[model samples]
Target: MLYSAKDYQRVRKEKEELDLGRSQFRRDFARLLHSPAFRRLQGKTQLFPGHESDFFRNRLTHSLEVAQIAKGLAQQINKRTPAFKRRSIDLDLVEFAGLAHDLGHPPFGHNGEHALDDCMKKYGGFEGNAQTLRILSRVEKKIQAAIGPSDDICGITPEGIDRRLGLNLTYRSLAAVLKYDNPIPLRRKKDTPLEKGYYESERELVEKIKAHVGVPTASTKFKTVECQIMDIADDIAYSTYDLEDAMKGGFSHPMQLLAKVGDESLLTKLHEKVAKEVPKVTPDEVFAALTDLFMLNGADTPALEQYTTSKMLASDAKMRSEFTSELIGRFMRGVSVTHGTGADIKFSKVEVAREIRIKIESLKHLNFLLMIMSPRLKVVEYRGYEVVKTIFETLDSEEGHLLLPDDLQVMFGRLTDTDSKKRLICDFVAGMTDRYAVEFYSRLRESGASIFKPI
Candidate 1:
């Protein structure tokens, strides 16, 4: 076996019963599925809310899809590689990683993430990956504490040590969740708001995962194979699923989006317009210079074999580029969600192959340009940050912090500096649902919204 039960560290004390040769990692993955933090994902955003439309996916749905895809990929690779087949990667571990990957996302999609990152910058800083670690190891602790001897409650399990606690997952499951290697408070200080990995609040959990895996600190810099599976599953889902959502929203037709690619005049105009607004670039000339030097100059490369061989193959290289561009354009128009049987699973390998991953990523960069960093989005961001900031202001106060459970409140008091306080504040904010955040803001702001009302 690639990894034995001993290769994993169980967070909760276990009696070492049920020596199921499937390995302890599989059991750990199962525990995560039953955790409250994982359940919270059902309410969080994937691209948009579930109420927006019937076709789009939320984080919970997305996580499930990623798990499926990761399992398929792991199985495929294991079957293809002799060594992997002999002592193969565990599918359950990868699936669990994919499922629990986004357990830390704040409400309102990436908007909430950006808002919290900005709000907590003075504290310890917030990134989704870091926040995921925080959720599994800490915020979930609060949820456990809230349960408080309530055996009558639904969804409560007392399988291991610390009955009311975080997902006490095995180390293998946790290791698969750590996609990026960079530590919190990023090595190079920047204002981009996105970090390569988790926060300082999760140092202990990180250490535990690493120690259990027997990975050297330096070797832990990249993702494990399971993590890679999860990451690729994420990319596949985002590239294809987001495209479907964008198409459903009617921002731009799939075909129309494709036509814009490699069109010199259009590229020139897009560069001019986008450059003026993009934070990373100063002017159209600079944008054009950068694009040509990097993307455009390299665009005419040979088509990947996958494109040539797919059932819905693009016959010409130019057409292939156009199809890829259209796919991205279709995805970028916008996103919404609705309730349905969840049967839409069509995906294009030509769109997400290694050769096209970077290109697709470049187009999704518009997510930064048109949606995330756009001024209109910034207005929403401003409001979100303000809401979070005000919540922090209230919660960090003597009385507000006291309202929390004794342990968290004590942790808040024990924190000595602005950074620590901010992290505590993020812990509070990150745990909120969309309606909860709005309600909390209203209550704190005295917005005349009824405190007795349940959303």
Candidate 2:
């Protein structure tokens, strides 16, 4: 919140060419919102396809919601805090970061991310967050470069530094967009094991952001409070929106979802897994725990009081752990209490709103386990990987090589090493969408669908 549109330094050399009405940061961030990559988010999955149900939120809608929430948070903090006001924290930067945060998510949501990460393990790996950064700064150029720029696009000249590549964002704007503070290579793999942040390929850009913005990376991890706000906003949207999608798709009704948490079979599984000392007496407490978790609301004082009271019962470590798992189960059922704003998608409230965010994120690990990594999802992932693999192999063949870009053709023609070629092949396939991958694979294999226009 320290910097503003006025304070942001321009990345472009032509200060005289700069538009007086819009600041350099604002202009760059605005371009991202209007980008084809940003628009492609509409076709990408959130929890499920937006076409699957009208009630569900797609990636585009979700990003718009996050942007609104982030801007609201910025305005509120700036108004309340004298330091924020003095520092001139631009709402546009926060809004832009929120909007562009998830632009690089592949098809099939996090399942696609897992598949890509596994596929690209030797090639510096893959991460959704890192992919998003890559898209804004690089990958989008694959398409944009093929087509010449129009008046709608700003500072995009093919010749000058490949300005078409990155969002050409100011250092501060890009920094605001980075939710995770730690760079990939500097991290100890065993110290904290999570692959949900920026990638090693992005180190140079990271350094540029740090140096230009005058921010320090202390404690080996550093995130601005603004980034924290955007991260929490993303969390709130993800938890609630996924639940909404499930409900609309008839995956789980709220009543049945609540009932299933303490179901007899689930209780048996929990007891067996947790190995509670007082097995006989703990089941009822567990039932109460499950109920308190699913039914608890944090939007009102009574709900907060109930949540607090329920937590008081978790005095012992075993009870706490048991309760935590039960809460997770409820979340995985994809059921959530509605606040009746008709999916209004604003996160502007102060006191109780923060608590809602806390409750949602508390179950993130559970959500990850149940829905994200479940056998059903993995089956789909396997299918997606097969599609990518087949496509990559076909494209590398003599017949398929004809479809490639000129640079790719020349590089592939000259490259003799299998490893380097395979990496390039992965890059090509990684850039394809679910439909594109499937279509290309089908055509190459002479399979079910027709690749050419049918009469």
**Highest TM-score among the candidates is held by which one?**
1
Task: Name the 10 consecutive residues with the lowest summed lDDT in model 1.
Answer: 339-348
Task: Kindly list the per-residue Cα lDDT of model 1 for residues 1-455, writing each as its tens digit.
Answer: 34645456566656655665655666667667777767777776565456667766778888997788778776766666555656566777878888888888887667677667766665566778777766666556532433334653322233212233366666666777887666667233446546657776567667877666655333324456677667766765675556455445544333234334446664555555544434344334433433432232144544443223321222234543454455434332221111111111001011234234433344444334433454544676667667766776677676777655455665565555656556666777776766667777887666747646642
Question: lDDT for model 2, on a 0 to 1 scale?
Answer: 0.56
TM-score of each: 0.70, 0.68
How many clashing residue pairs appear in each of the predictions shown?
Answer: 7, 0
Badly placed stretches (over 4 Å) of model 2 are 4-7, 10-20, 142-165, 183-194, 217-219, 263-357, 363-379, 393-401, 405-428, 446-455
In candidate 2, what are the lDDT values of residues 1-455, reduced to their tens digit?
Answer: 34434235534433533557786657767678778778877766676544555656678898997787667666766666555555545677778888988876766566566655655555555667777776665555422333344642422343332333455556666666676765554324333333766776577777776666555323234454556567756765565555544545545433344456546776554444333322343545544543545554432547456545444433334543454445434432332211112111111122223223234643342344345455655676677666665665566666676666665565556555544455455555555555655666667666646536421
TM-score of 2: 0.68
Residue clash pairs of candidate 2: none
Top model number, lDDT: 1
